[model samples]
Target: MTRYHPFLVFLHWLLALMIIGGLIMGGNVLAETPNDDPFKLVALRMHMAMGILILALMVIRLVVRLVTTKPPHADIGNARVNKLGTAAHWLFYVVVIAMCASGLAIANMAGLPAIVFGGSGAPLPSDFSAFPPRMAHGALATVLTLLILGHVGAGLWHQFVTKDGLFGRMWFGKRS
Candidate 1:
């Protein structure tokens, strides 16, 4: 129910783009394509790499969140809404970190080099197997999807029904 801090807003959008890209790549066309195909491999690899970046960014966001005091939910509709919103935010954080941790472990085991956004060479240990990467990739993808649905659903409820400032905290105002 509290307004998100400025840094949280920045991190949310930053992570949002990464998450959206992965979601789009998860489309049926992309999922059904052969892994051996160069284009398919590249696309999959790109998605995996983006997942790695998200892992890193989420870590940073968690650290920031831990140290900062969140803004008040004084203007929020009521106690029930505020509690749900708060729980949803923490769920988001927990799921994201879980996904990231799994992804990084997979990357380490899969021998796919770590990928940095707009940068080169994150060189993961070469001995890591592809299995861990594949497993983590699947697990994290599932978690991210569920959390996303919950997030969107809550946003819609706030925007359409309560006329609360919940969405605006992340989209426009600080937790208003």
Candidate 2:
């Protein structure tokens, strides 16, 4: 039996909070942006920055998971909990990476400068000019919706049915 990687657990929940918050906020920003307003451009640029940060943190998380010895799990925790978790996590990464790429794509379609969260800027790859970022962003958002539903369902299962400690690790930083 392996012990829960406490630090990894912390980063996981923290990133989840940030990603969900950013997504919800970005959606509102996009909806509220006026069709003819220049301010919409600025808001999109900032959304790009937020996407970049999410990408970087996700990469860091992947690296950490690669090097760490993940704790063991008991089968009875939930009937299909492990499978759902694995799928949800990988899909979560896919949607996040796609969101970042799509944000850059949309910016390129407008011929705008790259919005780098870490520094002054980076140029958008010329390939991003092919189409609007909306397609990819929309696809990612759709998947994100499903994943969020799956995640919540799993949590409720743990809370009400299985009565397990799985959710506790991510929610409160340790097993109850």
Clash number by candidate, in order: 4, 0
Runs off by more than 4 Å, candidate 1: 27-30, 73-84, 114-133, 172-176
Scored by TM-score, the top model is 2
lDDT string, candidate 2, 40-156, tens digits: 656666666677778888888888877876655445555686676776777877788788788776766655563333334444343332466776776687678778888888778
Cα lDDT tens digits, model 1, 18-116, are 877766775454566664444554664676677778878888898987886676653465788778767877887777777667666665554445342
Error of 1 at 133 (Å): 6.0
Task: Predict model 1's lDDT versus the native.
Answer: 0.67
Model 1 error, position 129 (Å): 11
Scanning candidate 2 in windows of ten residues, the lowest lDDT window is: 120-129
Q: List the residue pairs that clash in candidate 2.
A: none
Once fitted onto the true fold, the runs of candidate 2 whose alpha carbons sit more than 4 angstroms away are 1-3, 73-81, 114-132, 171-176
